[model samples]
Target: MNDHDRTASEVAHSLSRRQALKVAGGSALAFAAGRVVPSGADAQTPPSQPADPMQIILPETGITLPTDEVTFRWVDSGDSKALFFRAYFDAFTQAHPNIKFDYLGLPWTEIAQVVPLGVRNGNAPDVFQVPQEIPIAEAVREGWVRPIDDLIPNFPAWQAGFPPVSFVEGVNVFNGRVYTFPRSTSRRAGIVNYFNRAYLEEAGYNPAETPLTWDTLRDAARKVTENGQGQYYGIILVGKQVGRWEQYVRNMGRLAGSSAGPDDIDYRTGEYVYTSDGYLAAIELLLALRDDGVVFPGSMSLNDPQARAQMPQGVAGMIFEGEFTLPIWVRDNPDFEFGVSPIPTPSASFTPMGYQNTGTNHQWLYAESKLPEVAAEIFTYLGSEAGQLAFVSITGGSDPSVFDSVNQRAPVDERMRTVYGIYEKYMRLCPDVRIKNPETSQVYLRLQRPTPSFGEIVQGIYTGQLEDPKQAMQDLQDRQDQALDEAIEAARRDGANVSRDDYVFPNWDPTTDYLESDYAELG
Candidate 1:
């Protein structure tokens, strides 16, 4: 189905907003219901003197409280710019008055080093938030964290709401159990192409509306380019950084029915749809834009922030980015004329306009902590409806499920409305893609040397440094296998289970042919 041809009904059938809410019942509803105490009730009054954190009840899921007050220390990676940690702490404290939050805000770069050290020194917060890429499974296997299954019953609900893909499948799960719950879900979509309606009209074209397909984008770029010369180009893309390049590749991969997950492409089988006709077609189309001079000059050198800056200043016509970019655009240039829509799909089949896997950022509780019960209560409440609402309100803009009540109570920007609309109708959590064996994560990290070094591989692909795609993929597979092997060996030396066959990969192939596939159908 073409992007335009695919209806909200079609996407809804796979993963609807209502179903997402139901699957995320505890979290979604908790956020919606507000505080459990009666309105104007003094939750900390003499009689109520804030029951020991262990005494708090997770009423939403019927989970009992712990016997001790658990102090959850968390650090925010995306702080200052975003209030994610503060919102979570605020909602958590209000719901469970006894539990205290030792909140810390840190840059993303510092979290990797700080978290591990904190764990060694016994100073790690009982409950903390970590980025999806930080090898959490290894932490779990190392006894730094705890398995969450014994604490709550709504885990299944949390898992069902995610999409079936490699990254989600590979990074979130360890030993067939979930260790993290995502904070904000994200997907790679075509960048929001911002056009100066004023500029388009001056160039003899209607700027108010434009088709989302690649061809339309190119044609519009051509028209816009004729008017501006070197001062502006029809579009801007991040090509210099491997991370941005990988995003581009992944976005293109989505159009071809692939993602960064194992199920979509099956790296083990050496079958990648990336080199397939559909993917190649998407690449050719993108390259055509570059060749036609429709892309901004030195686009390869531009990072996301730099590219976004051009949009408000009218230095560029269109740029592709994620949904998060909308808020910044609104904050910086209130009067900029722009519209939002899904990326266009290929002519053959209607792939959803956006990528499927939403990023997973989760909070885990320590099983061995002195306050498991209290920690569980806080964990459950944070995942509850009231908690979700509090988070949404504090963050200002979050998924509709988190802020559904607030969405109804206040007027929201069109961009936010658009994001909620898309998520409600079409968003699917990418299947769990993290390492199942916590030890394997350690190996992956060791082999990669520095975590960000993986970008070099991506850069090689974008810059044509690696001429053989098959070899490049094979090398990655080897490195991953080696990493897994190293992790397993280390575990064995430590008398832990680390066998090569011990790792379990989730099955996320949507194209699998099955007689009983109806159960797997999105509807």
Candidate 2:
């Protein structure tokens, strides 16, 4: 059967021998050897008339663009980089005119609520960015999402461009089946400092030359705030989004020598690092800054968009965000001179920030979509060499591609280039317990999140709702430790082949990429 003719069930169904053969005999050629879009158009495939989008041929891909009338929807907590996705959806429609490519951008808070509701009502987008509030494993086990390994032609070729651990069993994969490909990478988000060049300079600091450390960040913010005299502030943040608190702490905490950094798991011991010394220090610094009254007075109520807009109007000196901040500033506040740097550390000396090797493992496809083929096609195309390259070129590295080849060739400004350098120099791939034991996915499904989660703890402490930061973190940590132990046991009882030992990695190194070969050494 032609791809456009399959039902959603058939589209997501496991690849049978016959289906495998069909995929092999069909469009495998498009993705191989880094050639998704044909550079040279063949004269034999003449152009179709433009009046009808269905009849239009994509000269670049050498594929006749047409399909049965279908509405393909995608949603995300959209960002500046979403421009690239919006454009791709339009082009995708041109390639398959029958596809009414509908894109929806919502705040992640709404998305967290919206996705599960949509899935329950059978009205979710064909593809939606994972809210992270709902565990992916639970979603997969409940039949809300299916494996993507069978969807693409020559899956291996498509997966190769991504770095090691891009897909992990307990993470983006479950039971040997991959669920999603990271359309973006972590380097693009929540690990960089966006500073107003003038404010930093007036405060007698060069952010680019002297990256903010815990103490220095405090001093700088205080000095800038004093200069503002209540008119503007030292920094603005999306205090309404609790996640930003944890992210900023993690970024700086990692830079200050936290073993876990952003991963939250210290690979060396395979344990949580919520109360790591660096993490505690980062919290103290933030608390001191807040006590200094350097934080914007209205920051607590503002969302990211509001803070981002306010920053250019001189409301604050800095924001710790991803690379995506640069482009929006360029577009909306072009005259606002600014600079970027790695997130501040607790101390002056640098410590490598660790990340799970998985790319931006945020988006996922809904299981019961009416246009699964079209959804799959969009994912396949984006991961393609052509798609990745176009993404960078169009977005100008607003949200970087996981593929380095594309980012290396991207046309972006100085700030993006500077931060990409920071990402390369400091980013290390941490160990994935999933590669050693896939059964941990069950543990995740069963694992209860500790009361007053990391974000909540940070918020509570920052806002004075929590009296003692260390005690609060330790309490949460203990709860998490106990919760994890209980979850592992429960999963084991449920016949999952997981053990508490599965989470331990005695030989793992914090400074290097934990590849399969590293895991093999254990065996």
Best by TM-score: 2
Local distance difference test, candidate 1 = 0.49
- Per-residue lDDT over 1-523 for candidate 2, one digit per residue giving the tens place of the 0 to 100 score: 3212332234223222221111211354211011112223334433321211111123342223335687777887665545455545544554456777666666556677888889899888888876655566668767787777887767887788677567877778776788887776765436588898899899998879987777788889999999988888788777877678878777777777777735487767767888988888888887887888999999888756666778888889988766766766765466889988877776577777777666673667888876666656667666765566666655557777777766777667777889888888777766677667777877887877666678878988988999998899889788888988999999989899887787777876767766778888888
> CA RMSD for every model?
10.9, 9.5
lDDT of each: 0.49, 0.69
Write down the lDDT that model 2 would get. 0.69
Poorest 10 consecutive residues of model 2 by lDDT?
A: 29-38
Q: Pairs clashing in candidate 2?
A: none
List the candidates' TM-scores in order: 0.59, 0.84
Candidate 1 per-residue lDDT, tens place, 1-523, comes to 2111222223223221221111121343222212233222434532122222111122444566543565666554432123334333444566666666666644333555677677778877676655334455555656777766567666667545333431332345555565555554443342444456766666555533433566666777887888787787787776654445544555555655553342223322324344445554655566577679888887777655566667777766777665656654554356788766545554334433232342434666654466665566555655554444444433335333322343454333666667566444333333221234445444332322233333455556545676665566556555555655666576577665455443322343433321224223422
Per-candidate clashes, comma-separated:
45, 0
Quote model 1's TM-score: 0.59
